[model samples]
Target chain A: MDQGNPLVEETASAVSSLSEEVVRVEGLWKVYGRESKRITSDKYSQMSKDDIRKKTGNIVGLKDVSFSISKGEFFIIMGLSGSGKSTLIRNLIRLIRPTTGRITINGVNITKLSENDLLEFRKKTFGMVFQNYGLLPHLTVLDNAAYGLKVRGLPKGKQYAKAMRFLETVGLSGWEDYYPNELSGGMQQRVGLARALANDPEILLMDEPFSGLDPLIRRQMQDEFIEIQDKLNKTIIFVTHDLSEALKLGDRIAILHDGEIAQIGTPEEIVTVPADSYVQEFVQDASPAKVVTAGSIMVEPEVLLYSWEGPRTALSILKNARRSGAFVVDKKGILLGVTNINRLERIIENPVESQTKRIDASAITKIPSVSEDTILEDLFGIVSANPYPIPVIGENRRLVGVVRTDDIFETISPNRGDQND
Target chain B: MIDFPEIIRIPLRDWIDEIMSWLLNNLETFFDAVGWSILQVMLGFEFVFTHIPWFIFIPLAFLGGWRMLKSLSSGITFALMLFLIGTFGYWEMAMQTLSLVSASVLFSLLIGIPTGILMAQNNRAESIIKPVLDGMQTMPSFVYLIPALMFFGLGRVPSVIATIIYAAPPVIRLTNVGIRTVNPEAVEAAKAFGAKRKQVLWDVQMPLAKPSIMVGVNQTTMMALAMVVIGSMIGAKGLGMEVLLSINRIEVGRGFEAGISIVFLAIIIDRLTFSLSERTSQNNQSHE
Candidate 1:
C-alpha cells in the first residue's frame, strides 16, 4: 500500500490494529423460509441461491458471509437491491437471525445470546439509521432523537441533554419541536442520524441513510456525514447501492453480489485493482478522477535540489538526470519551491549569487502545491493553469512526489471512456 | 335430488343451541356479574346524558364541534342538529340511545383493541380471531339479540351486550390491520434502537396506527348506533323503543319522527368522528 502520504499512513495504521476487532462474522448464512437450517450444509454449498431456492423452497438472503470490522472503521457494504447488503447489516445487529453462523461483537457471540440478552445487548451496542428516516410520525424531533436514550431507561433530563447535543451535532438544533412530517427528507434523516448518535452505541448501522434525499441534498449530507464520522470515529457499517457514495465515504468497501462478498478492499484498490470481473463491472461507472488521489498517481522526483546547494550543483544535477526542472526543498525535504536549469543557469552567470555562495531565493520559483490526498478531479484547474509539475505535499509541507498533468489525464481517460460507454 | 338429503343434514343449529343452553346453565354467576357491570356503566352514562338540560347540552355540543372540527359553521350545524333532535319530542329517548351507543362503543374498544393487539402480535391468534370477527360482522344483527337476551334476560344489559357483539368487529379487525400495517421501517428502526417488543408497540406502532384505529372507532360507533333500533326488539328502551312502539301501533307519522331523530344523531356523530379521524391522518402528511 502507498503509505507515502500522511492521510494514507493514518488509515494504514488504523487498519493495522487487527487485534482490536469490534465486530466479527464467520460463516454467516441467512436463508428465509421453512427448514432454513437444513440448506446450510454442503449439499447446497455448490448450488446458487436460486437453485437452492428451487430445490428446498428457501430464499438465501446471505450465504456464508464472513468479515470483521475494526473499531472506528467506516465499512461500507455495497450492492444492488436483493444483493443482501441490507441482510448483512441486519444480521450484524441480530435483528435478522442467521440460520447458521456466529457473529461476535466485541468478542461476545451475539448469535448465542438469549432473546432478552440480545435485546439488552442491542440497547448498549448498536444504533441504526434507515433510508426511510424511520422517525415516529407522532413524536417531535427532540423526542425522536431522544428515543434510544428513553428506551434504555435513561433519566428524562439526561436523555434530553444528550439528545440535544446530538441534535445540534447534526444541525437540527432549532427544529426540536417540529414533527417528522413537518421536516424535509434531509432534515428527517438528520434526526435519524441524531437519534442513532444519541445512544452513543459502539456501532452505527446505516442502511442507505441518504438514499431518500434529493441528489444535491444527498451529496451535502454525505459531506456532513464524513465530517461527523471523522470527529466521532464510531465504527459505522453503511449499506448503499451507490458506488460513488461508497468510494466517497467508506474507508473500506465490501461489494456484495448474490448474497456473497465479491471483493473487499479500500476504494482506490476497488477502483484501480478490482479483485474480479464482477467487482470491475460494479465499479465500471465510478469516475476514477473523483476517487483517485494525487498520492496514488504522483511520481517521486529522482532529482531533488537542496536549497543549500549552489546553482551550479543544481543545474549539473538536473542535467545529469535529464530533467528540465527540479523541485527545490530544504535538507529536511520540506518543499520550498521549484527551480529549472534555465533559472539556475541565469543564477550562475550572476555575481550576486557568489556573495551568498548558495542558490539565491530568486532562482526558485514559487508554484502551487497540493496535498497528497487531493483527488484528481480537484487538481484539474490547478494542474492546467500551472506551467510546472505540481508538487505533492505531505504532512508539514514535505514534498513527497510530483504530479504532472499527463498523470491526471492518463488516470482519468480510460475510466471516463468506460463511463461514456 | 330425490329426497336423499335427510341423512346428510348437519345439526349446526342444534349444536349451537345446546352450547348456548349449557353456557346459560353453567355460567349464571359469570353472566350476572358481566350484565350487572355493563348495566351500571350504561345507567351511569344515561343518567348524565338525561340530567344535563337541553340548554346546556346543545351549547356544549356546539363548543365540542367548534374545538374539534375548528369551524364555526360546524359548531352551529351541530347545535342545530341537536335542537332538531329535541324538537322531535324524543330528547330524553335520544339521550338514552346515546348512552347505549356510548356504552357499547366503550366496551367494544376495551375488548377489541386488546384482541386486535393480540392478533397483531401473533399470526396464530390473528388466524383464529379473524374468522370469528368475520362471523361477528356477517351474522345478522337479530341473531345476537336472541343469545344476548337469553344470557342477560331481556333489558338494557342484553341490549348493550347485543350491540357490542354487533359493533365490535370493525374495531377489532381495523385495530389488527392498523397495527399490522404500521410502517415496517418505523418498526424496524425502533427494534434497531434496542426498543423492546412492548416499546415498539406503544412508541412506534400504536402512534402510527392512530389514524387507522380512529377510523375503526368511527366505524364501531356507527355500527353501534345501527344496533339501537334492532336492540329495541329485545325490550331495550330509547328512540329505538319509540320506533318499536310506533311500529306496533301502526303509527307511521310517529315512526318517521323517531327515524328522523335517529338520522339526525347519526349525522352529528358520524361527522364528528370522521373529522377526528381526518385530523389524525392529516397530522401525518408532509407539511413541508
Candidate 2:
C-alpha cells in the first residue's frame, strides 16, 4: 500500500529539524511591469495594492511576504482571487520572477540563479500542475504524461515505462492513447497530475488544479489527491481560493490578503482562533463542525473513578462534582462504563462487609464512546441519546478525554470574536 | 469638375522605373544564377511527370488518392477524371501544367513556411512582413510578370517565378496565423516541462498548427493553378499555351478542349489535397 510507503518514511520527520528547510522565502515582493522596483521601495512599501498601483503604475503581485515550508508538508497558500496567492506560488518556482526576494529550495537560493541555471533547476526540483490542465492537445495521454521526462533527455523506453507507471498510479491505466480533448475535465487534470508525478521532483506545486472541475468531480478529485499525497508523502505547496479545501488538505495553511500573509497555522487553530478581523470573517462561513475534531473540544473529565473504588467513595466523588453519573475505567484507563448515584445507592443498601462484593455489576450502563479523531458533527447523534459524557478513546481503547454535550454546543456556536468581525 | 492639385509631384513612378532598370542591369549575373537553379528543378519535375505513360500515371494517381483520402471510390473517380483529360488529347499539356503548379507550390512552401514561422516568433518581423504579404496577395497577378520578365527574361523560369509570387502569400499568411493562434497554455506547459524554444516550436506548436498549415497548402495550390493561363502569356507551354494558341487562330474546338482539360486538372488537384487535409484533421480529432 502507498499509505506509509517506505520510500519517504525518513522525510516525515526531516521537516521539524528547522535546518532542513525544503523551501524558504524571505522578504518576497513582486510588482508587475516596469515600475516593480520603484513600487517595492521603502517610500511605497506601506501603501495599499491599489494605492501603490495608482501612484507608480505597477500592480503589486506579492507584498513583503516571508515563510518557510518544511519538507514533506502539504502547505497551502489560500486566498481569494487577486489576493496574490497564485503569484506567491509561481514566484517560489520562479515561473513569475519576484522583484525582490530570496527563495531557497533544498538550501539552494534559487532567486539568484541565471536563466539557464534556473531552467535546469526547475527541471530537477519542481513539478507543477496547473488549473487549465495544460495537457498538450495533440499528444496522447501517455505521451503527455511522459513529456517532462522526454524534455529532460531521458531515454524513450524508460520515459514510457515511468509514464505508464505514473498513469497507473493516477488510475488512468486503460486510457493511455486517449487525447486531452476526448477526456472529461477531471480525467484531463489527472493526466496533468500524472505528468508532474512522472518527473518525481522534490516538490509538487499545484495552482487551483481542481477549480475548473465540476463540484462533485472536484470533491472526488480532492479526496483522491489527499490519498495520493498520503501514499507519496511528497512536499506539496497547493494554492486554492476555497477555504474548505485548504482546511481539508493542508497540514498548515497560510492565508494571504492583499498581497500579505494574514495568518498561518493548523486548520483547527485557524478556525478557532483567527489572528485578526479579516481572518475571523474569512472563516465565518466555514462549518466549524467539519473543521473541529473531537480532540479539539474534548475536556478532561473531573469525575472519573477507578472500578476498585467502593460505592460510598463513588457517591462522594459524584457529589463533589455535582454530577448524577460518573464514568468508571479500569487501571489502564480503558472505559468500563458509566456508574451513577442510583447504582451506588443500591449497592449501599446491600451493606456487604467486602466493598467489591457490594458493587453491582448489573447497574453499570455501557454507553457508546467516540475516538479522538471523530469530527464534532458525528458526536451530535451519540451525545443526544445519553446524559453521560462521551469518553474520547485513543489507541488500545484507553480513555484520553471526554466530550460533554456542552462542549459540542459551544464549539458549534460562532466564536465571540467572529461577531465583532 | 473637382480636380486635385498636382503641386506635390513626387515622380514616384519614374523613380521606381529607374530603380527597377538599374537593378536589372547590375544584378544580371545573380538573377541568372538563381533562374538557372530554379529552371533545373522545374525541368526535373516536368521530366518525371511527362515521361510516364497515361496508363501507368492514371493508376499511380488512383493509388495516391486512395492512400491519402482512404477512399477507394474517390480514387477510382479521380482515375476516371484523368482518363477524360487524356481522351481530350491534352494529356501532355495537362502534365506540363501540373509540373508548373507543382514546382510553384513546392518552392512557395519551402520559402514561405520558414518565413511564416519567423514572423510568428518575432513581433517586429511580423509587423514588417504583414504589409508585404497584403501587397503580394492583393496586387494584380499581371503586375508581377514585369518584375519576373526583367529579372529572368521571358521563359519558363519567368512564368514559374510569376506564378510563385501570385500563389505564395496564402501559405505565408496562414502559416503565421496558424502558429500564432496555437493555444498559449500548450506552449507554457511545454516550457514548464523544461523544453527549449526550438523544441517547443517543433514538438508542440508545429503539430497543433498542422491543420491550418495544410489548409494554406491547399489554397496555395489552387492559386498556382489559377495563374497558369497568365503564366502562358510569358512563353510557358502547357494547356494554358494551347488555349492561347487556339484563341489566336480562332479554333473554338481546340480552345474548348484545352480549357476543359485545365478544369479537370484543377478539380483533381483540389479534391485530392483538400481531402488529404480533411483526413489528417479528422485523425487528430478522433484521437482526442
Candidate 3:
C-alpha cells in the first residue's frame, strides 16, 4: 500500500508531509554502568562500544541513536544481537532509560516526564509484543489478554469483553479458558499479541515477536500481523535480527550496527543502492526480484499504435521502429491490445476499407498485462510465457510503460551473481 | 598439637551476650507485646483444633485431602493416619502440637514472605539477609532457646518464638529464590503494559512464584514439627511433652507411642502440603 519510486527522494519527502509524525527520538544514548554519563561525552562517543567499555567500564547499549516514526508506518529497527535494536525499542517506551538525549512522542518530551507520568503515558501510548510471548503462566488466556485492562482498573465485564474481541481477531476464540502453557509457542505469542491489541494503544512496539516460533508459523504470523496492521492502521515499531523479516514487513527499515545506524531506507533502496559496504554486505543475499517492482524497471516503448490509426500508418511506424509487434492504446493511453507486423500486413492486403473503419478487432491480440506495482518476482512466469513485452498498467487501466524480459533479468542478475560467489 | 594463642581469640561470645542482655532490658515491652499476640494466635488455633469433635475433624480433613490431592485413596490414608494417632492415646497432645505447628508456620510465612520479597527486590537486602538465613538454618536448635527465654520468659510463648527461629529460614530462602527466578520476560511484559510496581508483584511475580513459595511453606511446616520436642524442653505442652516425660521416666512404650503419633502427624501434614505445591506447578506441564 506504501508503493513509491525507491530511487526518488521527492516521493519520500511527499510521504513525510502527508503522514503526521508520532514518535521522534533524537541523539538518544543508553550506556550501561555506574559511570554511564562519561560515555556520552564526545571523546568517548567516538569510540566503539567495546572500546568505550574497556576504557571506562561502561557498556554502550545505544550511541547517538536518532529516528522518527510517522503515523501508520511499519518502521523496522533491524540488526544482529548486541546491535542496540532492542535498546532502541525499549528506549522508545522508556522501559530502559536513555542516558542522554530526548524522546518526543506526539509533541511531548517524554524523557523529562517523572516516573509516575511515564507510567501513565505508556498506558495510552504503547502496546508491546515480546519475543518470549511474555504471557503470565498462571493466568488463563482470556485473563492474560485482559491483564493490561485489569491493571488500568477496568471493570471485570468490560475487560473480558475487550479481551475476547482481540482474542477473536487473533483467531484464538476457543482458547479463553486455557492457560498459556497449554498452547503451542505460536498460540502463546498470539495471546501476547491479543493482550497488546486489547489496550488499543497508539503504537505497537514489537521486539522480535515471531522469532521464537517455527519458520512456517513465523511467516504465517508475519502475514497475519501485516493484515491486522493494515486493518488497524496503527503505527508499529518492529525490532528484529532477521534481515528478510525486516524487508518483508517494514515500510522503511533502519539498519543498526554496533549501536549506530548504518542506513535507513525502503527495502528497494537498501537492496539496489546500499548506503555503504556494511549495508551492501548485509543486503548482499537479498533477492532483488522480491523487492524491485515492474514500475521501477519498465521503459518507454519505441513504437505505439493508436486504435484510431489505420493499419497502413501502423505498419509504417512499425517499419520505422523495426519491431515485430506494437501495443495499441486508446486516445487517452488506455491499453487496448497488441498487433504484430504480420497482422497489420494481412489487414492492409485485404483492403477492407468499408468493414475495417478502424483497426479490426480480429487483428489485435489481447495478452495478459500486469499492474505497475507488481514486483519482479510475480512477473517471471508472465514474462517468460509471453513473446511480447508486458504492458505496465497504472491507475484507471492507463498504459504507463512496457517491461521487457531483459529488464527483469537485468534487475535480478546482480543478486544471482553475488549468491554464486 | 600446638596450643592456640589466647591473645588472638575474639570475644564474640561476650559481645553477643551483652547485646542479648541490652535487648532484654530495653525492648522488654516490645517483646511482651509480640509474645502476647503470638500466644493469642496459638491459643486460637488450639481452641479450634481441640473443640472440634474428632469425628467431624477427621472427615473434614479427609475431604480436604481428597479435594487437594484429587485422589480418594490419599484422603482415606490421611484419615487412617489421624485415627492411628488417636489409637496411640495421644490425640489430645497431637491436637495441641498441630495448633503450635500451625501458629508457628502462620507467623513464619507472614514474616518470611515479605522478607523474601524485599531480598528479591534489592541486591543489598539479599546479601544482608542471606547469611542470617544461613545461620538460622545451620545453628543448633538449642541455641535459639536462649534468646527465646530471654525475650519471652519460660512458657509456650518462648517455645513459639524458638520454633519460629528454627523453622522460618527455608520459607524465606525459597520465597526469595522463587520471586527472583520468576520468568523475567513476564515481569517485563507486565511493566510494558504499565502495571505499577505493586501490581507487578501481586499479579505477576507472586502468582508465578507460588509453587516454589508453596514448597518453602511445606519445608517450614516440617521444620516447625521437628521443633516440637525441643520446644517442650521450655515448658510447651503437646505430644512433645509426653515424649519428654516418657524420656524422664524411662518408659519405652509411652515414648514409642508419642513418637509414633508425631510421625503420623508429620506424614499427614507433609502429604497435604506436597499435593498443594503439585497443583500449583501443574500449569507448567504441557498437555500436548
Candidate 4:
C-alpha cells in the first residue's frame, strides 16, 4: 500500500497525467424495468433473489455500478455469464444509458447528449469489438473494415484507404476482398479489429472478443492483443470469464458479481492477497510466488548466501543456494536466501521444468537467473518448459535460487470455493 | 333408340319451370341489385380532376416528382408530357386513368405495409400472411376484375379496385421480407447503445429495411401499370383506351403505336422507381 497499489497505478497511468480522469461513471445503472427511476434506486437492487421470486419484478440488468477507466490502461472486468459485463461495456459508449449515473467522457457527460450528439460522440470515440466478430456477412473484408469510417460520412475512397491500412495492421493485408463467411474465425476477428481500428478511436471496449473462437485462436488472439497493445498503447477494457485470460491481458482486473465490482487489483494481488474468500477462490489454482515479483517476497536485504566455485554445477548450486532451499536474489545482484527443503521440493515438482531451461552461450544447457521479484505464474511457465527446474542465476550468471514445481502447486491449492473471477 | 333416349323431351318442362323460378326469385333480382350497388360505389370516391385547371397540378406534380424521383428533368418532363397529352386531346381520359391507378396503389400500400409490419411482429401472423400473399399473387389478374365489378362498377372506381388486388401482393411480400431480413445484431447493437424500442425500429430497422421495401414498391407499381391496361376494358382510360380504340377500329398502325407507348411508359416508370430504390440503398450505405 505504501508503494501505491498496482491497480491504482495502472488506473492512474490509464488516465491522463495532465488530468486525473479519462472516463468516469458515477453510479451507472441499467434496469429492464418499465421506468428509469428503478435503475437508480438501491431498494430494487437489494431485494433478495427469493424476494424477487415472490414479488415478481423485472430483472435488474446492471445496478448502480460506478467505476472509471483511465487512459492507456488494460482494464479487465471478469465475471460469470449474465453478470452485466456486457451492459457495462455498452454504457461506456451510451449504446445504453445508465438509469441514474452520469458518465463523463473526457469531462463530457455523455448521458446528457442529444441523439445526434450521442451518435457523433460514439462515431468519434470508442471502438467496439464483440465476441462473434460481427462482420457484415455481405461485405468483403475491406468493406467491413471500412464500415466505421464509411458510416461516419467519409468518402469511399478515403474510407477504403483507412480500412486497408488497418487491415494490414491486423495482419489481414492480403485479405481485403475476402468475404466474412469465407474467412476463418480468427481472420474474421482480425477484420473486426481492423474495423474498430479504422476509426482510430481512443478507447476500446472488447466484449469477450475472442470467446467465440477456438482455443488456439483465442490464445493467438490474446497474444495478438498484447502485441497490438505494445504498439498502440491505447486504453482497453477487455471483458472475459476466463481468469487465465484476465491474467494474460489485464494490467488491472475488476471482478463483477451480480452487477457489482467485487474486487479490483493486479494479477498478483488477486492471486496472493485476495481481498475476500470470493477473490481467493477465484485465484485458487494460481501460485502467488509466481504472480508476485521478487520485490513482493524479498525479506528486506537480510539473508545468508553461499558463494559457490566458478562453473558451479546445477546440483551443487541447488545445494548451495536454497541450501536451506531456494535463494531469491536482490536487484543489486546480492543473494537473499529463503531456501529450505519444503520450498525446494515444491519448486522441483512444478509442472514446468521441461523446455524452459537456460542454455549456455555454447550448445550446453545453463541455469535461469530467477530473481526474488519474479512472479510465480511466470516461473511456473518457465519451469513447465524444462525437465529439471531451471537453475535460478544471478549476476555473472551465478546461481541464486532453484525454483521447483511444488512451489507453484503450494501457491495455489490452498483452499477453493469463495471467489468468482 | 327407345332406351338411349327419347331425346330427354320430358325434361323441357322442368327446365322451363326452373328457369322461370330462377329469373323471378334469384338470378335477375340478384344481378340487378349487385349491378346497381357496384355503380353507386364508383360515384362515391370520384373526384373531378378534369375541372381542376391543368396548370395548378403541374407544380404539385413536379413536387411529387421531385420527392419520389428527385429529378428536375423528370419532374419537368412529366409536367410537359401531361400538358402534351391534353394538347393532343387525350388529357381527360389520361388524368382519370392516372388518378385511378394512383388511388389503388396508395390504398394497397396502406393496407400492405401495416399488415406486413404486423406479420413481421408475430410469427403466427407471418405464417398466415405468407400463404395469403402467395394465393393473391398466383391468382390470375382477370380474377381481380370480377371482384372489382361485384364490389364497385365497370368505371374508374371498379378498375382502381381491381388494380389494388393485382398490385397489392408485392408490398405485403416485400414488407415481410424486409423486416425479417433486418440484422438482428444491429438491433441488438442498437439496443446495447441504449436505443429504445422506437429508436431501434426507426434508426436501425426501418433504415436498413428500406432497400428491400423499395424493391417491393417497385414491383407493386409495375404490377399496377400492367393491370391499368386490363382495367381500361372497364372504362379506365390513358394509353390503354387508345390501344383499345385502335383495336376496335382495326387501325393496325394506331394499335401498334399505342402499344409501343405503353412499353415506353413501363420502361420509364419502372426505371424511375427502381432507380429511386437503388439510390436510397446507396444513401443508406453511404452513411454506414
Candidate 5:
C-alpha cells in the first residue's frame, strides 16, 4: 500500500486511464490474387476462400485478422515484407478494402462511407507517413507540409502557420523552404513526421517510416517518435519487419505470418507464449529469460533459501539451489543481490568472487518484474538491461530461484541443444 | 522500226494501260478521303483559335511557362518577347503554326493518354499498341506530308494531320509510365483508408503520377512544336513558312528572326506547363 514514487504513480495512472477499444476489427480478410484478375466481390460480405480466389484471381493479402487497438496503446504489427502487416493497416484506412470484415472506427463502419465522406473522414481523423518520404519533389518543405490543408480547402495563412508549428516540432523550422531531394533521409522522415502531426490526427498510421534510413538515424528517430507519442497519446498502428523495433515501441504487438495473425499481445505475451511455431522461431534466437516473466521461473517455497552468503558456500549452506542459481536478500528480506552458477567461474576456482557481478539495489532498472500477467516483451527490456541473469520475485517480495538467461531460452525453445551446457 | 506500228497496237498492251489508269484513280480517291479529314480538323482548329483573344493566350502561355520552368521572370520575359515578335507581324504566321501544333498536341494527349491507360490496365492492349506506336513515331517526318498532301491537297489541314502523328508519342509514353510508377503502397494506403476505387485512381494514383504525366505533356508540346515548322513545308503557314520564305527569297534577317522565334516559343511552352503540374502535388512530399 505504499504509493511512494510520484513519477511511477503518474505512469500507472496514465496507463490505467487508457480505454480498451480505439479500433475494433472483426474477421478482416483481404485476398490478393497471384494472377491479374481483380478481386470484385463486395469487400464487406462474407465469402468462402475458394469463392474469393475464383472471383479475384489474387493471392490472400490477409486472412481473418481480428483485433482491437486500445486507446493510448502503441500497437505494432510486425512481419516480413508481404506478410500482410501493411495490408492490415491499409484496410483499416480503407486504402485497400478487405475482402470481408467489419472494420469499425470510433464506432462507425468506415467501409460504408461514400467517396466524399471518406475523404472527409481521412482529413478529419488520421495522418499517414510513408517510408519513401513521398514528399512532392517540387515543393519547398513549407509548402509540402501545408499540402493537406490546402487540398482540404483550408485558407493559406492558417495552414502555413499550422505547418510551421509542425516544422518547428519536427526540428525542420529553418529548412522549411528546402526541397526533399536536397535533404537527407532522416531529415525527410522528420518532415514526414511533421506533416503527419500537422493534422493532429486521432490515429497515426506509419508504414515502416524509418526503415529506409541509416541504422543510427533509425534508432534516433525511434527515440524521437517515443517522445512525441508520449505527449500526443494518439493510438498508433505501426508496421515494421524489425522485431527489435516491435519490442521497443509496441505496447502490444501482433505478429503476422503469411497473411494471418500469428500472435497478438503485449511484447511480453508474444515473446513468452508465442502463439504458433512460426512465432517460436522468431523469438527463439533472442536470450529467453529476457522474454519470460518471473511467474514462470519463480522457485517453489520448499526450494527457497535465505541469506547473503558468498557464492562459494552454495553446496553447504543452500541446498536445492538448482541449476538456475539464487538471489541473496538481507535480514529485512528485500532483494539485495543475485548469482547464476553457470555464468560465474573464478580464475583459479576462487569461486567466491567468481563471475558474480553485484547488481546494486539501484542498478536494476525499475521496470516491472516479469509475471504471468506480464507480456514476454516486457521481460526482454529488463533482461536486455542486464545480461548476467535476472532476479525472480514471488509472494512477500521474496527472492526466488533466478531465471537464468539460459533457462529462458530453454523454456521457450526446448528443441535447442542444452542451453545450460 | 520493224514496220510493226499497227502490229504493236496489241490488246494486252491496251488492257495494261487501262488497268494502270483504274489503279491510279483508286489511289487518288483514298488520298482524297485522307485529305478531307485533315481539312476538317484544321478548319475546326482554326475556328477554335479564332475565338481566343491573342492577349489571353499569350498571358496564359507566360503563366504556364513560369509555372513549369523554375525561372519565373525569364519565362514571362520570353513569353513577352514572343508576343512582341508576333505583334511586329510575325504574329499571323506564328499563330498559324501555334494553332496547328496546339491542335495536334491536344488531340495527341486526348488519344494517347486513354490508349496509355488502356495499355496500363491490360498487358494485351499494351502489347498490341506498342508496335503501332513505335512505327508511327519512327516513320520519317517527310513521308508524313506526302500522304497528307495527296488527300488534303497541300494545305494547313493536311499539314496538321501529319503533325498530329508526328507529335503524339510523348503523351502516350508519359501517361503509361506515370500511372505505372505510382507508389503501390500509397494506393494501398488510400484503399486501407477506405478510399473507393475511383478515389484510389484520382486522389492516390493520379496525384502521385502527376509529375510523370507533366513530363509527358512537356515532351508532347516540344514534339508538336518540332512538327509545326515541318508542317509549314506543306503550306501550313506559320513561323516555318516565314523561315521557308526567308530562305527561298534569300532574306537572312527574316529567316534568322523566325528561327529565334521558334526557340523562344519552345522555352515559353515548356516552362509554363511544367510549373503548373508541379504545383498540383505540393503536400505529398515529405521533404521541402
Candidate 6:
C-alpha cells in the first residue's frame, strides 16, 4: 500500500530482502501453573527454572528467549522434549501465548495483538504443518489442502485451483479425492505441506513434521521438504527434537535448554563452535562430518606459484614451505594445476631436447581438489588417497585455500586443542 | 421399625409438584406451542403409516432391511416378522404405535443433539446436565407420565411428551460423549487452520462425532418404542391398548397374540435402526 512513498518503499524492499530480519523475539518467557505473571517480576525473574518450579510449583515452558530470524531462512529450533522447543515455536505462531515478552514479526509486535487480530494475522501470515500430519478425516485431500484458503474466504473455484496447484507441487495430483486416513503417513504429510502452502502465507511454522515418519520415509520426506523449500523460499521456523534433522535442514540453528536458548548460529557454527557445555553435549553424538565443510577447515595455501613460473621456481616454493606440492594458478587466481618437488626434479633430470617441459607432464593435471562449499565427509576418500594437500577452490575455480590431511585428522579428534585457526 | 422418623418428613415430591405447577402456570404459551408442533408431526406420521397398504409397507420394510444390512436372510426375517404381526389383526394398532414412536424419536433427536453439542462445548453445562441425564435414564418411566399428564393433560400429546422424556437422554449423553471424545489433534489442526468456532463445530467436530451420534439415535429410537406400551395407559390407542384389553379379559391367547405383535414390532424397528446406524457411520470405513 505504501509502494509509492520512497522511504516506505525502501523499508518494504529492505524487509523483503532474503537476509533481512523478519521474526524477532525479545525476553520471551512462558511459565505454566499458578500465578504465571509472578515469573515476570524481579522476585521470580532472577530464580533459576528449577528453583522456581520447586519454590512455587510452576513449570517453566520458556525462559527469556530472544532471537531474530532473517527472511527466507530455514531456522530450526532444536531441543529435547522438555526443553521448551515446542513451546517456543508455538509461541512464535501465537498458538501458545507467552506469559511475558514481545514477539515482533516484520516489525509488528504479535504479543500485543488482540484475540481476533491474532487469529486474523495468523490466518494471513502463518501456515503450520503439524507432526501428526493433521488432516481432517472427513475431508478429501483437496478439501484438506483447501481448508486454509476456505477459512481465509477465498472463492470456491480459486480455492480448488490453488489447492490443486499446491497438491501437484507436493506430488499428490492424483490423490485429490482420497480421504487422509486412506493415505500413507508420508503422503498425508505431503498433503499437510500442500495445505500450508496453498494458503500462500509469508511464513511456515512446522512442528516436528517428519517425527512420526519411519527412518526411511523420514529421510525421503526431508529431501522432499528441502526441494519444496528451495522452490518456495518461504521463511520457515521449524521445531524438532532430533539434532540430525535440525543440522540437515537449518540455515541457522537455535539450541534450547531448559526453556532458554543455549545458542543460535549456522549449523557449522553450532557444531564447530558450540556456545556452552549444554550445546556441546547436545551435538557431541551428532556426526561432525555431516556439517563440517572444507571452507571451515581450509587454511591459506603455504606455497602457490603463477602458471608462468618454471619448475625450478615451483620446487623452491614447495621446499621452503616444507610441502610436497605447490598449486599453480593463473595471474587471475584461477587454478591451473599442482606441481611437486619430486615431479620438478624428475623433469629437471630427464630434460631431453625434444621434451623441453618446465614441469612433469603427469603432475600438470592429476591433483585432486574440492570446492569450498563441499563437506569434508564427501572428500574423505579423495583426501586420504592423495599425498598432496587438497586445494580448496572457490568461485570460478579460484584456488582459495588448502586442506591438509593433518587438518582433517585434527577436525576428527576435536577435543585435542580444539581451536579453529 | 422406622416409624419414629415419621415426624421428620422429606417433602421432595411437594417441592417438585410446586415447581411443576409454577412452570405450567408461567410457561403455558410455550408449552402450548411445543405441544402443537409435536401434535402436527405425530399426525403427519400417523396419516402416512395408516393410509399405506400392508403390501406396500411390508415390501418397503424388507427392501430397507436388505439394503441397510446387506444380507438377504435378515431382510426375509424382517419381512416375515412384519407379516406375522399383520396376521395377528393388529396392523392398524401397530401403525399407531409406529407413528407415536416415530414422533417421539423425532423430537428427542431434535432436542437432544443441540443440547449434547452445547454440553460438549461447555464444561459447566456438561457438569450440570450429566446428573440430569443420569436421572432421566434411571428414573421409573412411569414417573414421567405424571409430569406429562399434569402439563399437557391425558391424550396423544401427553403420551408423546412422556415418551420423549423417557427416550431423549441416550442421544443427548452419547452426542456429548461423542463430540468430546473426538481426537484433540484434529480439533487443534482445525483451530490452527483459522477455522472459526462455528466452522470447527460443523466441519470438524460434527463429522468426526457422527458415528457416536448415530449410535445415540439408534438407542433413542429403541427407547421410544419401549415407551409405546406404557404410553397406552394415558388413553393413547395403539398395540399397547390391545395388550391392555386382553389382560382385562384374561384371554391368554389374545394377550399372547398382542404381546407377540409388540415383540415383532420391537425386533423389526431395532434391527432396522441398528443396521441403518451401522450403514451410515463411516466408522466401519476406518479399519484401524
Q: What is the DockQ of candidate 3?
A: 0.59
Tens digit per residue, CA lDDT, model 5, A246-355: 88788788999877788888777777567878898897765443445555664443333344343445433334445454455766665655544443333216544444
- For model 3 chain A, where is the 10-residue window of minimal lDDT? A1-10
Best by TM-score: 1
Candidate 6 deviant stretches above 4 angstroms: A1-18, A48-50, A319-322, A349-363, A366-368, A414-421, B1-10, B246-256, B280-288
Q: What is the lDDT of residue B14 in candidate 1?
A: 98
Off by over 4 Å in 3: A1-15, A351-357, A414-421, B1-4, B8-10, B284-288
Return the lDDT, model 6, position A176. 96
For all the predictions, what are the DockQ values?
0.64, 0.40, 0.59, 0.06, 0.14, 0.47
RMSD of 4: 14.6
> Could you give the fnat of all candidates in order?
0.68, 0.37, 0.67, 0.04, 0.16, 0.38
lDDT of 1 at B120: 95
The alpha-carbon lDDT assigned to residue A380 of candidate 5 equals 61
lDDT of 4 by residue, A193-229 (tens): 8888888888888889988888998899888877777
Instruction: Report the C-alpha lDDT of model 3 over A188-297, residue by residue, as the tens digit.
Output: 99999999999999999999999988999999999998778757878899999888898888889999999999899888988888998989889988999888888899
Worst 10 residues of 6 chain A by lDDT: A1-10
DockQ score, prediction 2: 0.40
Per-prediction TM-score: 0.95, 0.88, 0.94, 0.59, 0.62, 0.91
DockQ (model 4, Cα):
0.06
Candidates sorted by DockQ, descending order?
A: 1, 3, 6, 2, 5, 4
lDDT of 5 at A76: 92
Worst lDDT window (10 residues) for model 1 chain A? Answer: A1-10
lDDT of 6 by residue, A1-421 (tens): 1122333224334545646888999999998988898876767766788999898989989988899988887899999989998888889877788999999998989999987887788788899998887678778999999999998899999999999999999999999999887888889899999999998989999999999988999999998888787667789999999999998898789999898888999889998888999998898877778888888889987778776666777777778889887778887898788777777777766656225434434557657677765677877888768777888776566888999888887787756444655
